[model samples]
Target: MRDEIKGIRPPSNPAAIKDALDDIARIRGRPLVYPFIGSGRGRGALVELADGSVKWDWITSIGTHFFGHGDPEMTRAVLTVASADVPIQGHLQPNGEYVEFLRAVSSIAPGRCKHVWPSMSGTMANENALKIIRQRHAPAFRVLAFENAFAGRSALMSEISGSAANKKGQPDMGQAHPVPFYDPADASSVDRTVAAMDDAFKKHPGEFCAMHVELVQGEGGFRDAPREFFQAVFERCRRERVAVWVDEIQTFGRIGEYFMLTRLGLEEWADVVTIGKMLCGSAVLFSSEYNPDPGLVSGTFAGYTAGLALGAHVIRRLRADGLIGLQGKIRALERAVSERLQVWKSDRLIRDYTAVGAMAAFTPIEPDLDSIRSMVRKIFDAGVCVYYTGHGPYRIRVLLPGGCMSTDELKEGFDIMERCL
Candidate 1:
């Protein structure tokens, strides 16, 4: 660690970064601590913190770095764009790169979402998507998201989320509603939940504009709605001409397919779809209807030229590499681990174990923020990188990227996690 720091050009003060974070906390009126100290080397799926610790990366820039940082091709693409981007920033500069990238992303979009409204972050992209719902259709078009489904942190997203913290200062849409999500493990629980959603539809009737969802619900503790239930939801939405939105911000790409609905066959049933985190690799994506009105939804920095170039290049590479065909490799890895590890026995504190694609999480045998943080901190210190999606006291989540972590690396991380518990 000392050598790495000493070699850095002119040296960067570690304290300065911490000081800036503290300043931001004060400015935002929040006390959130900086979770991970990014090395910024943008190399391998690993982190070497200032304290001389090594870690395997499950948080690939929150999975945006699916190919891991320092990818030669991605690096080359970034360089290629940086040189040409000076021209993309000009006023009213419409270029083919931006349009081509949009075409590639729309080609992969689920259902009827052939057009996209790109944004700087997933939060704003979602906020824009909501406007499309309210503006195009009647203001009475209700926005419905499943309870515990977190879309983003914007005010409108907060209004859709069930958390009081997010909703506290956020304004609300009078026509929005939330339904209880379904869980299949509890037998009748899924049917009962769907029954509740069915009832909700009756209450709202023709007021619904779109039904937003994160198929796997990664933020809500890696909980996936029952496949049957999802099919039912899609059917219901189609029957009523209500938009079915699959929030692929977290679940997209990680599951082999671009969206979970593709894996579950809901793409044919969906209406509006939103995707972010690896659309053009770093650029966020929110799409609905092939082409909204020119001024229907626009952002100052949305769909910047540089990001468009990267997106176009990435889509070509993904298609050429047969990435979709590699999904079986993801499922095979999960089966191999589940079968190979005897230590993964169920316990009273173990709420569940979910592994799909490169995304996986194991609920703990008695979870808490301290316990979760301690486990993750220890993992970083011990050299296996992972994340903690806090969901009560019964989850020790591990979010791995589909193409990021190799099978051997994933097994090693799991082994370390077993010891951590």
Candidate 2:
């Protein structure tokens, strides 16, 4: 461990933490599973809790904190924007920070996705992307998405997402057309998906506007598919004249590329893309061909000024520090995690492991939801913070701090997980 985070220890004031959690539960009308509250101080991947305990924060707020906590560059970026006239930039009037953020995102975005629109969250970015695509392909309101894909939780997005639980009790929008996602374990996964696509298109000809894909499904259990799988899917979309929308909200930056499409050699297939999480602010990047008409997609708040500054800074810093590319820090950490997971799999401690760059997940020996929940709680109590994904047979997910966490620290986290297991 680094000298700064060497003081990590178990909680010394459980009573105080319980009291705070009680207050939180009262205010939110529900209780948190882990009862976590940050002390507003941390170093790299290690964060201190309000109750005087420190834990390895491997999830990084569901892949938002790319550089982890208390990063000097990130801190400097925030301080630089702290003196801005307005805290939040808006569509009607945006500051230079917004322009700079756009420039930064555009500089690293796929060449075809030239136009950029910044938003406050990934869901809003997806909403904008949806509006743009739907406007371009009017009368074709249905969207094609993969099964087990998670778009977001907005009313429209809930309809579009593959999760039935998310859309429960809500009026059906009847706009989503889900096909099976790629299954690496199945030899005919690609062919099956292609067949399903053909079936959907044949059944509802000229009714689909776009196909939304997560190159690496984050909330859907950190699963990934081979490039060939995406190539086949995108080819079918192209043949049907349906727009291809890549949702890189959780995979951006953490993946060993600025854009996952660029890394997979499928950049040309992307007509529109939505990015968020690690960017600090969310954005919709689209081709000129898919740009929406005037007054179609506008929001009141663009984003916080500091977040925009940090987003730009993160882009530049990632490039400057050589944290991207095939042989970069991100892939290095991914390799380390994969190696450990492989060993555990061999030992039958884990059933299977899936990963793409820093986003990873592994099914525990006891894969039931209740067992997985118990294991996660134990892991948290043992000084590591991780989350689970998927339904039924759950898998523990980890979003490593690729920019700030060292291999040694990652191994330490694995050790904690093993102890919990």
Candidate 3:
């Protein structure tokens, strides 16, 4: 079986992969993250790179492959769709996958979320969310979002995101107002955040249509907002009639709870929710009250047929495996990572760590961008793959697919990380 799987992977031509990367860089007119290509041979927690080298995939394609690479069930689901010759693009004709996939997503959504708008990417899902909010609250131009929030790469969402860097060289929508996110131990954090939102609301009274939050910021350093903090913020948005748009692009399935709104107890207040990454298909789940007018939300491609099938399979499998249920794999991985952090705390090289379920991030004591990047590269070279987050004070963020990885496997990856450090 191992040999058969190996044969199924990409041609083990390291030189060919390297040459392709060079060609891509030359064509795109910029340097790229060279020397890495997925071989599609990985099973569970490990991946075989195009260079014929195997490494523990701690990043899991930036939380997209939540079940890890070459998962048998995922493969089977995709193969089933492929065998049927389902159209790659399904916009012209409605398919059963669309209905079944939406049903699967709706099953997990809050009761009020009666409508689902399918899109090709997280950005488009968010874009649709904004469109729905705009249609529901016409002429209400302003939006509310947390500090360092990341929405998507699209022009409109780039404006909605809190990062100024993302909006560079793009025309500003100039509609999103930034507010402070929750800090767990900070007693005054909630008040400070509320004050920010209140100030923003007062500045643009009746102009704010919606507020988007990650609940747990993913790219912004995996920081989490406490339940009380989220509840207080949601209350303010509700009072101001601002639709709550939660961006679960990176936080969806990997957060252990399947949905961060539910994990953070903000599901009831979630007027619009955007989900992507591990689910394969990205979508916006909105309440009936926020449904948009016709011609407002449409896409050329909702998602690929295989992704749609695999998404439904993933949702069902995760539920059956209890990976998203209480004290499940998410919590188990969190505990494992937390235990490791506890031991690393005594190490002078370790600065701080944050372990939130399946996502974990840590910073070095003497941190710099170059050092962080070098450390990540070293970790990858040392047979484990992780990623970096944040700027100025960067962190090593590891998004492990705990549902498919064992605690011992996690320890082994951490061991490689330690050796790399």
Give the TM-scores of the predictions, in the order they appear: 0.85, 0.96, 0.94
lDDT of 1 at 249: 78
Alpha-carbon lDDT, every model: 0.64, 0.88, 0.81
Index of the highest-lDDT prediction? 2
Query: Please, what are the lDDT tens digits per residue for candidate 2 over residues 113-219?
Result: 99999998999999999999999998898999988889999999998886768988999877898899888779999999999999999999999999999998877
Clashing pairs in 2: none
Candidates arranged by TM-score, highest first: 2, 3, 1
**How far is 204's C-alpha from truth in model 1 (Å)?**
3.7
Location of the lowest summed lDDT over 10 successive residues in candidate 2: 1-10
- TM-score for predicted model 3 compared with the true structure: 0.94
Judged by whole-model lDDT over C-alpha atoms, candidate 1 comes out at: 0.64
Error of 2 at 276 (Å): 0.2
Sequence-dependent TM-score of model 2: 0.96
**Candidates ranked, most accurate by lDDT first:** 2, 3, 1
Q: Write the per-residue lDDT of candidate 1 for residues 1-421, one digit (tens) a residue.
A: 3245335544347677577667767998974433455655544555544433345667776755676655777778767767663534321555676667667877777765666655656776676676666565565467777877888777677777766666786567665577777766577765666576677778877777778878887777777765788887767666766766677777766676667878887666655566667654333334444245667666555555666676666667655645554445556555655553434755433456777666777766657777777767776666666776634643555555555446776677667766776
